[model samples]
Target: MATTTSSYTRTGVLEVYAKQQWHKVLATLEEDHLSLCLDESYEVPPITNNGTLSDSEPSDIPESIANTKRVVRVVKQDNNGLGISIKGGKENKMPILISKIFKGMAADTTEQLYVGDAILSVNGEDLRDATHDEAVRALKRAGKVVDLE
Candidate 1:
């Protein structure tokens, strides 16, 4: 006996199929709970100093250095996205800064999160040196919940 096979020729059919498969797998993985993990990676410019080191110096040195800092932000969807600031840095630790740009809902808190808030981890993964873009991509790929405050 011979068996016949069916094939799809529509555009993005493969993508759709893959998405369905992923959803099915995710569903099975989360059968015990409704928790979802979300993370985002973004680029943070290095600190710059333009002031002269000394007044006696004839020329002023550009204090700004070009270095890349990777920031990964994680948020739990089911928990109302309540957490500390997502911005990666030690200088600014306000939640308002993070909430200002997050595409999703923002947390309600009296204290604000700033641009320099240090990011410690995402979904239990340490993001000490991860780039902002890398973190964002990883979070999106994980398909977790996220909220900005």
Candidate 2:
């Protein structure tokens, strides 16, 4: 018996390759007990002649670099006085309150410190001048005990 070889076409090759690649990926994930995580906000619709439209694009860039930075002011006040407001009078303020009350003979030593203390500085740099995320990252870098007083 003789066998003849026929030339293969490339039109559907990419699709076939993609399917095979997907299968390989799934197999690898199964073997490793890994899964892909997708955001709940993502929505997919059937493809049309005009192509699918994405509500947003996923980028490989870090959020710290991609997102706009804002300043978060820490204020000192009582539970009744605590209120958070967006800068430029945007909206109502959300207050940060502490529920645990400190009780001990050493209360005198801690009396100088109070619960509504906002982080005013990190590494001696005033947070009032820094952006919200920037101040947080700076505090993390400083390795100091962040507290209110």
Candidate 3:
């Protein structure tokens, strides 16, 4: 017996590829709980007369990401507690950063700590030069309060 195979045209192949890419984008958005509104037109907020930003035009405004320090007080629970992961060890020069924040945990509940935020200091001790293990140890040593910068 011989089996027959079906082949797709170039247009069909392109459509399949496009659908796959679109699905990937949608999956990413769903993971982040984000929604897209590419078809919708929203009103832009008028530039305020703040001294920091130029009231003249949007071009004059400086684009920058601000570094913020957040202090989170997490009470130890009987079972699952503060859920967070840190990265940056001896080999890497980057400071210890929050790698993940598990849902329903104290960190997630507090909403202060976020992924990618550097864990600068723990209880006044700087962790910039500390290895990944040291950083984890510092966080473990910190009782009830986690100070991050």
Clash totals for all candidate models? 23, 3, 0
- For 16-125, candidate 3 gives per-residue lDDT tens digits of 12421211111112332534333224333332332243222212112242354555566645556468877665557566766567778877786566665667788788
Q: List the residue pairs that clash in candidate 3.
A: none
Off by over 4 Å in 3: 1-65
- Residues 1-149, candidate 2: write the lDDT tens digits: 01122353111100012321211111113333534333334333322222543222222334453232223333323232222211111121222212122333121133332322234454466655555555445544543233332
Cand. 3 Cα-lDDT: 0.53
Please write out the lDDT profile of model 1 over residues 18-132, one tens digit for every residue: 3212111111123243322222232222222233231111112123411223334444456444433233232322111231333353322322333333344555555555666
RMSD of 3: 17.0
- TM per candidate: 0.27, 0.23, 0.51
Best first by TM-score, ranked: 3, 1, 2
User: Which parts of model 1 have CA positions greater than 4 angstroms off?
Assistant: 1-115, 146-149
Instruction: In angstroms, give how far residue 51 of model 1 lies from its true place.
Output: 22
Relative to the true structure, candidate 1 reaches a TM of 0.27
